[model samples]
Target: MPQHSPLDLAEGDPFGPHNLPYGVFTTSDEPQRRRVGVRYGAYVLDVHALAEAAGSAHAAVLSAGTLNPLLAAGRAIWSAVRAELVDALTDPARRVTVEPLLVPLADVALHLPFDVADYVDFYASEHHASNVGQIFRPNGDALTPNWKHLPIGYHGRAGTVVVSGTPVVRPAGQRKAPADAAPTFGPSQRLDIEAELGFVVGTPSTLGEPVPLDAFADHVFGVTLLNDWSARDIQAWEYVPLGPFLGKSFATSVSAWVTPLDALAHARTAPPRRDVPLLPYLDDSAAAEPGGFDIRLEVAINGHVVSRPPFSAMYWTAAQQLAHMTVNGASLRTGDLFASGTISGPRPEERGCLLELTWSGRDPVELPTGKRTFLEDGDEVTITAWAPGPDGVRVGLGEVTGKITGR
Candidate 1:
């Protein structure tokens, strides 16, 4: 829990020695070959150098330009590497060897840490789900019949998943207004942002076997901030029998750094009690323990802070989602990502997206420059998260940010 380190880290630095989150980076000087790096203060440690100097096999695995290789290596190697890095950073004698390899974060360009295998997005937050259900289905009950029994999710577009800072082109799709007799195709007018937390799957599982709740830490390598972009007008017309498609598949932004499950030891907390009994397969025993994280997630537009969604407010846990995902005999592959969709708390200010915050575009959110019901062209949306670190410092998941540009 000590905050002491050989590096000149600030007292409340999010990427202090306590948090050696992994990332993929390439500098302006060396842009051809991507290398694995770890965030420490304002510098990124060249993990390839750490691998090479130690002559560890982890070097070749981590040096593959993506975190996928190291992810497949599983928990044992992950623990070993993290421990070794912590020791190296803490050791005064090792400073000389480590200093030469440290690259200032300002000089490097961060890329997506891993190649996505499959993407699944789950609507796990009770507050967010309720808000959405009420707005969309005003005459019907807020929650669906089977909502409490299982974690509801759908497969997302893995091919469209982009790293932070990527420009989100406004999607041109079909939309029919209430008064319109026919649907029209054009650029989306109701573009929005969904603040989310993404779980990165590391180890692959058998095709017929399900990943149990206990295997969450073993299967899921790390967590990252995610922004699931939405086109409301396109979605409202198409989402009748089926769920989100072109309205959502446009672009989903993810943070550059992946904060390992090992670093989030202190952030665990219990979720709210379930009102209904879950099926045996979905009834994870980890629920008796603290299955939720106390991560404070924020959604911002332009330069204004709009909402603060708490991750702990989710109805279902991440472990439960993982268990339900593979319970149908579907296998997990390395780089498989599953996101906790739109984390929202009980308060009005805790809404995760503009849909809820503006009440389905009925109310406009007041800002310094102007009021907004939804994102306008050239609007930049940023999502960031942080939790209590080892000491008084905070451990950040970094930010997933993107700008809306006209097609």
Candidate 2:
């Protein structure tokens, strides 16, 4: 029997030719040199090697140690590179040339694909915001007054962002309970995970020019699974007058693979209905393309499936977030990352975070190991997601996982 080609992906494999998510990896033999690669089934394609072998024009950018160079190459170059990759992988004549560069995924070490220029986290889910509001202010309205108008977000520390599987050190900060006389400082008692999707910017905008809603695709390159680790105890104490600080800055984990926007054409869907009218810049009701994605996210702890958050149910779309983010003339950067905050649906099983699922420790979630209100020292949290692809295939977004370790 003829041997199976390394590119011969199994039927319905999430990381098939249709979903060639980009990442950076290094083999053990050359651990110091990081090469840009595309995930193909169970292997990582050495894009730089393939480009050099094929004498492709994109060889220079693909030779970079990180994705930043490719990201700065703009949308046209991105499309050309992706098309070349697909053709090279699918065409049988090139199999001999390509097969040599295919490295088994397990034999390589994945690193942060891009050096994050800036980080912003948005609260775009009505269900998640409402649940959080109800938990903290039971007597007040679930949705805030401005919730329906704009995407609420906060700038985060970019230096702390790590690749998936990196150990998350439990953050230590000051905390004050409702009945406490004074604040205390120590390791956070209520560590939590926020399942989110991060949008990566490829092309940048002018420093003083606001990017309109229609320009989202022109700038955004791809999406990644992001786990926004939160220290609820520290956040609660410090987020009164201002927003999240040390509670959130300690660590944020993202997937190694970044699924490009071009592969998600079939996943676009209309966002949830807006209760209030949006301004011209933020409006997308009459846009040519749907802004929201139909990605389905699953959150698991210690091998136990817990919640499934639907990205389609998010009130605000990524396009809207980009528009709002730049409305005040904030310039975009090649490696800038903006995240879709905890994606939750209306159902109880759709809650995205432990704070919502367990209701601020009032309700403990029962797991095979034991009950968990917040993440424990050794607890490992994993978030994986998939979106619809052409011909009914599933496009997989790489999973972001981190294990909690006491400081």
Candidate 3:
């Protein structure tokens, strides 16, 4: 009997030809040499090899070890290369040449797809922000005054961003409780996870120029699953006047695969109803495209599904976030990363973090392993998501997972 071809993926496979998410990988045979590849079914197609073999004009950009070159190559080149890849993989005549370049996913080690230029995380989910407000300030309003008007975000440490599967060391920092007389320093007792989606910037902008809402696709290349690990105890103590610092700086994990923005056309939807009128820069009322995505995210602890956060419920969309991020003339750069903060929904089961789901330790989540209010040492957290694709298919965003280690 003949072996099945990798190209002949089963119908409705998320990572089929329709979803060619890019990544960087290295094989044991050449562990030192990193190559750019695309996920197809359970195999990693060597895109550089394919481009070179086909004598394509965009071969140089794909040949690079990292995706920076290709990311910097603007939207036109990106579309052209993607078209070439689809034609090559789907054309039966080209299968003989393409088959040899395909490598088993298990045989390769995936790495950070690009060198991160900068990282920004946005508190765009109304459900998440409101829950946090109610948890911390039960007597006050659930939503902040500025919450409905603008997309709130903070710059993050870019160096600490890691690819999926990286082990996270439990962060140690100062913490204080109202009952305590003074602050104490030790490993965080309230370690938590924030399930979100991250947008990757491709084309850069001038230093003092602001990227507009319509240019979102021109600047952003793709999306990925992001796990912005948090230490709630430290954050609670430090986040006043100033935003998250040490609590959020320790580490941020992102998926190895980047699902290009073009693949998510079918997933685009209008953002949730807005009660407040937005300023001209942040307003999307006249935008040509629907900014919200219909992606559904799942959070898992030790392999047990916990929450399902809907990205469509987010109040601020990525386009709005980008517009607001650069409203002050902040420039964009290739490989710049911006996350959608914690994605949550109106339902209790849709909360994105343990801080909200467990209500700041007032409640504990029951798991087969044990009860958990906060992540324990050796606990593993994984976030996965998928969006609707053309023809009823699903575009998988892969996953970002990390296991916590004791300090």
TM-score of 3: 0.99
Candidate 2 yields a Cα-based lDDT of 0.95
Residue-level lDDT of model 2, residues 233-316, one tens digit each, is: 999999978899999999999999999999999999999888799888888989998998999999999989999999999999
Candidate 1: clashing pairs of residues: none
Give me the runs in candidate 3 sitting further than 4 Å from their true place.
none
Estimate every model's Cα lDDT from 0 to 1.
Answer: 0.90, 0.95, 0.95
lDDT of 1 by residue, 129-240 (tens): 8999899899999999989988999899999999999999999899999999999999999999999999999999999999888888989999999999999999899878
Cα displacement (Å) at residue 186, model 1: 0.4
Show how many residue pairs clash in every candidate, following the order shown.
0, 0, 0
Instruction: Give the root-mean-square deviation of each candidate in angstroms.
Output: 2.6, 0.7, 0.7
Q: Where is the poorest 10-residue window by lDDT in model 3?
A: 280-289
In candidate 3, what are the lDDT values of residues 1-407, reduced to their tens digit?
A: 99999889989999987889999999999999999999999999999999999999999999888999999999999999899999999999999999999999989999999999999999999999999999989999999898998999999999999999999999999999889999999999999999999999999999888999999999999999999999998998998989999999999999999999988989999999989999998889988989999999999999999899999999999999999999889999899999999999999999999999999988999999999999999999999999999999999999999999997
TM-score of each: 0.97, 0.99, 0.99
Give lDDT: candidate 2, residue 309: 94
> Superposing every Cα of model 3 onto the true structure, what RMSD results?
0.7
